[model samples]
Target chain A: MALQAGKGLLLKADPIAAAFREEVKLGLSKTSRRPRLVGILATSSAPSKFYAEFTRKQCEDLGVEFILKKTGAADTGDLGEGEGVEEAIIEANEDANIDGIMVYYPIFGVQQDHYLQQVVSPYKDVEGLHFKFHYNLYHNIRFIEPQSLLTSTVPSAASAGVVESEEPPPGTVKSIIPCTPLAIVKCLEHVGVYNKILPYGDRAYGRTITVINRSEVVGRPLAALLANDGARVFSVDIDSIQEYTKRPQGGADTSQRRYHPRHVVHPSNASLQECLAISDVVVSAVPTASYKVKTAWLKDGCVCVNVAADKNFESDVRDKASMYIPAVGKVTILMLLRNLLRLQQYKAVN
Target chain B: MALQAGKGLLLKADPIAAAFREEVKLGLSKTSRRPRLVGILATSSAPSKFYAEFTRKQCEDLGVEFILKKTGAADTGDLGEGEGVEEAIIEANEDANIDGIMVYYPIFGVQQDHYLQQVVSPYKDVEGLHFKFHYNLYHNIRFIEPQSLLTSTVPSAASAGVVESEEPPPGTVKSIIPCTPLAIVKCLEHVGVYNKILPYGDRAYGRTITVINRSEVVGRPLAALLANDGARVFSVDIDSIQEYTKRPQGGADTSQRRYHPRHVVHPSNASLQECLAISDVVVSAVPTASYKVKTAWLKDGCVCVNVAADKNFESDVRDKASMYIPAVGKVTILMLLRNLLRLQQYKAVN
Candidate 1:
């Protein structure tokens, strides 16, 4: 089954293009009084090139200022014999003219810790990955994370739904579901699949979801969010789960059985096949070069979501499958912009 | 197949009783200071008649003094009547010369809330039912609640394990497990069942456990405790589970076929039976004149825990059950004494 599954990018060419122009027009009116300078710092040419071009064009149309700062893909000199990315970050942090600063680390292997600590001021750090922000999350304090912001922008581009245009507005909260995973969940809901087993005709209850990852940016907080929606959750580390089941003497009792619907993390090609074979819905976040799921592994009507942009689609049963979603580019940027507008409105009122 | 489960009781019989006797002993040692006073307030004639005679004999043996405050059987207003009990409670609360105060309310429709506020001071509210103490529970602030103190007394005793100990050792943060339930859980543990489930098992991990009530004093907190111990929990109210599931159309996809092992709640006897039939372990807190569970309903070798004191045992099932545990009195008293002693030690050190 060649499934059409991937990230769902709700695109509106005319309306979204017009909305960007309108935001720029409104933003430019206030620029003379307080120059709204957006800053971009990136270690890779790819992300920097993409964001800089996109943001600069929007800024120009809105009459807002855009500044691009490139810290070439190299290690900080203090850590090794290489260019100092940390030094560039310090410069960005001290720049009084910058209204908002974004640092992009495109590849997974890059070590950005030193630069992260040195370059970002809490107020200007639009990503919200600073130590202070993380500590607040640990204590269950409410604060926006940059990833959440970036993920909402694309969905906000669609013409305001009836609920969106209600009095006082529904706020960005409803529209701000996690881009990749929420896209998968939304697809399931659209196709009359509510929860894992039961289907709701129209109104869907928030389904109990288990996410198996604890990386600072994704796993823990996502589990908390799912649990807050009345979902009983079990979050396990990928390595720990493997180690738990591989133990000698028939494994520990904890790994003996699966009694509930489970979500596994960053499954390998083989593991993905096993998970897809049993799951009603499968979501893959691993950045791979090709499709991990095989056509035969999925249940006939299962939903498959692929968020790995670099991955190629390959599945014989795609036509026979229920639905497949494809990944979209710069989806995070759209989400971030929507979040920024909401935050601005909140700050204005509160 | 009749299995008798071990049960334990905790009490502060040694030190507090010793202290009472010591006062009497010291007063009798002097001819001038021989007028030692002891008073009793009884809502039931049974305790008044029995304990009154016992105290009089103890006083006479030490050649001290004794006094009895009797609300006589005819004037023995219904314990469930809040106004009448409150009046007696206020009288006890104001009596200055009384060394210690004891108020007994029978289980026969006693309105505990009616007298609780008027009868107790934080210090002398030996029963720990006072508003200030109960409110502390809401904020998770620790204060003595007399009933909790009394119920915990038995576990405190059983924890001694046949050792004739007078006082708990200093600096003990006593684990005051509620006696009847603790005994039941411990009994199961002793039989090597649920041994793999540790003290800190996360119920969200999906172990099916059904608790038959949600009373904070017992059912709800115990459910939370079990869930914390890694058991998937199903809590049912004794009165509602049947009607909740049997309503015409079983509104809103409420079929047993949709039951997930994660967790469920049923509040009627029939639904509780359905849950029990499928459950690995069943905990009953339902107040019934006779056994609510029949031998046929239980799976062979299933663990049945009865936390209700008044439920009558049916001989057929009671004999064939893998385990049957009886409620032991005075455990709560032991738990309270240990807590008080531990508090005293901490106060001294800190």
Candidate 2:
């Protein structure tokens, strides 16, 4: 599954994603009905259209139901941009047959796009962008009673407090995490970045990572997920650098509290060079083609991951990094499918 | 307002809370009806009973309506612990006359009490423990459309994005923050810990803070709040230490995103001495009387705030600190009342 380059292993998303694909297939085989996913495309954007087609191909290959609902400029040439997106989301929300809903983003940019995100009911939101899921993601509320999604009450004793097990507790299910972040976590797990011997929530302990972006969709949430899992994360964006960690200077007594406060942030004044010098792993998602992480700055033998559509690492990245994952897109799609399956189960339980 | 002690100036909550008291009084005077708050005491715990009395006196002094609804063990000799607490909460939630609801803690300990917290409607939840408000606090969604509370959609363009203004955007209101955290922020603000000259939302920029204790109700949320406002906050709980910050090493390009990802967490292996040596401010809320932050470890001229009922700082705290605040109980009560006023406004708009 690993391709050895001149200096280090160059990894692709296929092998990591294949493992999840099998899991999804097995999940689908056991389900009573095929899970249906509705992808809403409302823009004339090239990337979004390509993504929609790509999603359709993946869904078709997996034998899951895929429906593309194009509106506004993406529809017939006469419509305005992002027009009828709300109605499309509402229709998908009301459709009992639709198990999951996903919207191709940047149709109207951040704020408007965020509103469209919320309009998708949390019950069927495959993207996991709804505020309910986002809240859980940020707070590290990993498992929840499926019934709690419909009502505020804790349905049973099993759902009373945080359960440390990876598998959901009795009468509870794993809360949906954002697909991209989940994909990234899965990638880290595949590459031995996550230490299995360590405790469940603190698998990334002792690792210092630098994630070069703070976009809500990927970088910020990914940083939070890693930090919550016990990593020292340097979240780099265009303006400033912030460090994320679960264990700060003085370790707290675990006996008193029911759950660990997931992670905390500390403003770092260190330069990119300083961060790169110390980082055990470097993940760059800078979208611009012009942006490149200097190979010379990276810590030798560190793992590197490039999440951008455009390569964000220099030609000689392998000279320093022990391993480099070119993209996480394939794994991300598998995560989306996985979420769809989970949402179906959620619906079934409710 | 500041009394010169043996070394540092002693700061009291009286002056700090007094300012907020006038603001609440003024807000009450302008309202058409007096704001009514219901405090549900369901425990025989001494602290809870004392706190209820304190809350009543404060409400009476401010000419606000206060109702003590004793249920379970606190009500009479016959009732079991936490009995009818959920019913009491539901009653307060449905009562048109009740503007806010606050339940005394440790009624049934962590999990059952957490469920009881969820039972309080967000509309009347002055304590801000409801998952909805906690979500907003953790995500740094400072201003929300008042109407957005009742519905999922954004009510207007004004409430679409994060607004940096201290004043709520038109048609929006400041999302309620947990009382203890808000009280700490206010204390920091009163003592000039918040730099007014800086841009809004980042007023705590460039300061390093250590917050001891990460309880869900106080420590964890306070750390998030401070970090969101651009302070580097070290969140110390019993089992672990976490660092919180909005800015990392390589700054994000501000032009690319609508809002900064509030804050990210990093697990630090640093000892308590290391954190204290660099911290510009130290706020401790450790509840145990035996738990005392060593004064000798503090950074010279640092500000110290004690938020626990029993002082968590050593007797010699003033030796190293430039300013010492003994307690924030008064400030926390005021913040609760302020939340009650805001909730009333929230109801009026809905």
Candidate 3:
């Protein structure tokens, strides 16, 4: 994908998502029964409705069973906002046939919506928002025994700081990563941002990237994922700009070191312009329509990915950038499906 | 506390620890029954034994019930190393009389010892090394309902992005912080590192700190705690230098931000010299006896703290530092006692 004069390659999520889609289809084909997914839509918001429809279409295309459980205002205006969301989640959690569960967020906004996230059983938590998964993700514990979830004890891998193999250990499986972050990672990998020869855990080493927005679902985890894989991630949020990295300078003796420096946060005073000036990749997930990444500030020939519903980059972003991916929704959906397939297998062993 | 020519104030842990010891004593006075803490010592290491003895004396002086449960090598030379530790933890978990449980770590080194950490019940986890607490710590969830532990849910505060009050909500209590990190924060607060005039969560704002070592027990959590409290923390480890910070540069509109910008990780290329030059406070927890912070590299008038059993600072560190705290062990013990009291209340409510 070479850039044209004063224009970059406009990349679509289709090819990246399509590869994962095939993998999910292959996973579904091996399953004894079609995996079932329950999506709880508690709000009448347009985005939620659109997402539910999109999920349904994807599920139908892949031959996976998907049920959209619309509650509260999403179902009927007569019902209170976010009403019955908890009950719906409980019902889905109890249904052994339901291999995965996803909730359309922002129904009751931040706090209550977060509470609803935890309400979903970890076994069926396809979104990977549950605290258990979050704990593993943040700590960089990549693999876990599915049966261990039933036990109160967690994997000691995070504390152990051992260099883990890409392959899961005996009787263990890859832990679920949040779909959006996973999607972003997969997209980056496809674009050759993750150097394949640079070892499994630190594949993105030597790359400095700036991620705009530090939202829990996307920005923060994406920053963590990239940093864990050895990218310098500038985590741009509303009030702060934090740098995330797994690399430490001026190395000390590591013989007795207990914990691997998993993506540690550092305070940065660098402005967006400063970050963009040096960034090889700039990913913007800032949701608001007004937010825009100035093309002039971007590093020449950088890769720009727009993750928000509205374009976070200016119209001329591609003019300076080597490649621009407008959205990752397709890749995210496939990642969710992949998680659903994994959860099904997880349920089988447990 | 004026610094002498070519020397700085040598601050002792006793004075700072004494203040918290009284607070713990006051908390103990209110309890109808003495809070019982079971210390599981599975390691025969000299340091572990010394720590066990230290904890016993502290508990004895404070009028709290302390029981030392020696297992494996700590008990019998014939027994295998780390043997019976899991069983001992299970026994403590079942004991209604035990308000808290703490294990002497490195029993079987990092991995197995971490597994032992999880074996200790969250309700009885005085060290706050449990995944639940670690999740809360990494994500900056300051409070949780005690009864919520019984359920599968977690605090939504981290995802909510709301500016939390210092006081826990009506039905909730302050979540247990890892004792060592809490002690460090308390010591900093005592020495005027934390600004009382600032809002509750971001007290360590406007400070740049360098924490040597990214060990699970001390260095990592301490960095997270400081960064979450609004300090720019550079987490220095054997192989990497990562920046930890809550503050972001080039602020965005916060109207619909779903998650508060928690302590974020950024990869830094800075050497120890560079970090020390800019840092207002320098905390070293590097375990090796040979490793030392060069006296000449430190920022002028910086507060120096040594958390390692072996001093990490050069003998002449005080020449440039404003104050130097050699150890926090005494303060850490008080924090443990405080957690025990809190756990007692947490258990009662649950």
Ranking by TM-score: 3, 2, 1
**Tens-digit lDDT string for candidate 2 (B113-208):** 554565677788898877557657766778887755654322232222254578976776888899989999999999999999988888898899
* Winning model by DockQ: 3
- What TM-score, over all chains together, does every model reach? 0.34, 0.55, 0.56
Ranking by DockQ: 3, 2, 1
**Clash count (model 2, backbone only):** 43
Off by over 4 Å in 1: A1-48, A51-64, A73-84, A106-111, A114-119, A131-214, A218-227, A230-281, A299-302, A312-317, A342-350, B1-350
Quality of candidate 2's docking, in CAPRI categories?
incorrect
lDDT of 1 at A148: 36
lDDT (tens digit, per residue) of candidate 2 on A95-196: 788999999988655533654566677788898876556556655778876766654322332222253778877887888898988888899999999999
Error of 1 at A250 (Å): 23
Q: Between candidates 1 and 2, name the one with more favorable DockQ.
A: 2
lDDT of 1 by residue, B265-342 (tens): 232344655766766666677666664666666655555566665543344444444555444223333333322233
Weakest lDDT window of 10 consecutive positions for candidate 3 chain B: B153-162
Q: Please, what are the lDDT tens digits per residue for candidate 3 over residues A102-206? A: 999886544335545656778899999875676577668788778766544345542423345789878879889999989989999999999999778888988
TM-score of chain A of 1: 0.54
Off by over 4 Å in 3: A1-4, A157-161, A250-261, B1-121, B124-350
Q: How high is the DockQ of candidate 3? A: 0.04
